[model samples]
Target: MNEREEDLRVPLISFLLCLCVLIGGIFLFLYLFVPNLSEPWFPPIALILIGFPWLLWVLTYIYTCIKRCFGVSRNNTDSNRQISRRASTMANSRMARNASTTNGSNNAKEKQAQLGSASLNSSHCSKSEDPSITSSQEIEMPLTTSAPS
Candidate 1:
């Protein structure tokens, strides 16, 4: 068998063995102590015996799930903070490089000033426009059907 399957085999076999033992013990206990199955207390006692282990297992599973969720969220927040730091550092370095390059060139400065002014003008134009009318309404395209040759 493969390494992964071999690793799983031991745990799987142990779990099956434990289950078999549990079932055998329960049956043996019921047979030895409770001969009368129809007794009022027998059913509740049997149910409790069977359900208690399952209840413990379910509670354990839920606790693990809650722990996993918190762990994942914690990891995500840590990763996000790392990514934000990296991005900010990269942006700062790029800005520094641009500043250094622009110092030697008048053309670069002129281009930067033009881009800034263009952005300002665009922002102003957007602010002056009526909010009720959308860009889609301002520009309309005509629909045309292709004629078969």
Candidate 2:
């Protein structure tokens, strides 16, 4: 299984176990505590109704956790894509600058231009100040139906 699918497996199993425990406890409680109320079906039926909300809560929790994993990966992917676009743009700009500089060198008493193209090429190709810094910005968003688009 992939990461998101793996993420759900443990939670789902735990939820099932919890539901079983809850239902078992409800029947146990009715058997022991509710003395003289002897109905064969009422105990199981009561357990089903009472344990339903707990089951729903567990299911919701599992779903939210799985969604959060996807959410984080998606944000990272979008940021990485944006950074790659910028890098490509910068590289193309520098290449155009270099090509123009090479072609314009034949004029008599030609002087190298600082701001024209050469300087821009040098500036962009220079080593980064911090190599470990990622271009992606992380923003916290609520993981719910009511979250902003």
Candidate 3:
């Protein structure tokens, strides 16, 4: 209650003081130009002086009202950016998970290929009937040396 009252008091006092000043200025103008009141230029100048501030205030009020209706603010955009950033992060993490899964499957396939080749070698060795060709014997291959530098 006290805070609200403090907030209202300053603007109320400032507005009253401004109103007093405007009215004093008008009164002074009237006293000085009483004889020229019938001049064609007086009414328009006086009306504009009095009406312009009110016109600006009405425009400002309407602007605020429209802004409220549209529900636009800095916080909304910041939160939306945060949400998009989080979604992108999640998508990146999911892609990483998928890539790791794919790599694991590829490794598993390589292990299966190695095991099948090993089994084929074992079967070929078992089918060999020659006594000279034993499983433990290692065939030697000649290595060609690069031409003498």
Candidate 4:
């Protein structure tokens, strides 16, 4: 409540004060400056019909200008989102590059692991075969297996 009072109360009070003053000034002008036509209400009514709408247009233009200056426009929001997305993409790419650069042993370890796995598979295959091992073990195994079956 206190914060709302501080932020909104003062401004709202000032706005209402100024609006009252403006209405008073307009009434005084219409009463004094504008000459009364033959009819009692025509001149005052004409001023209201013309000046009030024109005043509304001018206020609308000023409001749009202020909104643009504050960066609350739609284009500003879309552009800010585009910038944020690009920044995140750039951050991810930089992290990937940094990781690859700092870890020099990663490639060597990967290659060693792959070679060890291949040799382990060959050893398993050889153990499963129970025959007299020869120098031409691979050739003999394939020939014997294919010839019989």
Tens-place lDDT per residue, model 4, 1-149, is 44434677767766765665566556656666775623456446556644664676699899979978985666665465445444444444444445445656676455445444543343233445342232234333221111111
TM-score list, all predictions: 0.28, 0.27, 0.30, 0.28
lDDT of 1 by residue, 43-138 (tens): 456566556666767998999799877755655744654454444444444444475475667765664565445433332225464532323322
Candidate 1: worst-modelled 10 consecutive residues by lDDT: 140-149
Q: What is residue 132's positional error in candidate 3, in angstroms?
A: 94
Q: Which number leads on TM-score?
A: 3
Model 2 weakest 10-residue run by lDDT: 140-149
lDDT of 2 by residue, 20-120 (tens): 76776776677778867645875776677567667878999999799877666656755654565455445545544555566665431132233235333
lDDT of 3: 0.52
Instruction: List model 3 lDDT by residue over 1-149, tens digit each.
Output: 54445677769866865775586557557746785554556556666656666676799899989986787674675465445444444444444444555567675455445544543343333434442343123222111111111
**Residue 89 displacement in candidate 3 (angstroms):** 24
User: Which residue segments of model 1 deviate by more than 4 Å?
Assistant: 8-49, 74-149
lDDT value, residue 17 of candidate 4: 54
Q: Model 4 RMSD to the real structure?
A: 28.6
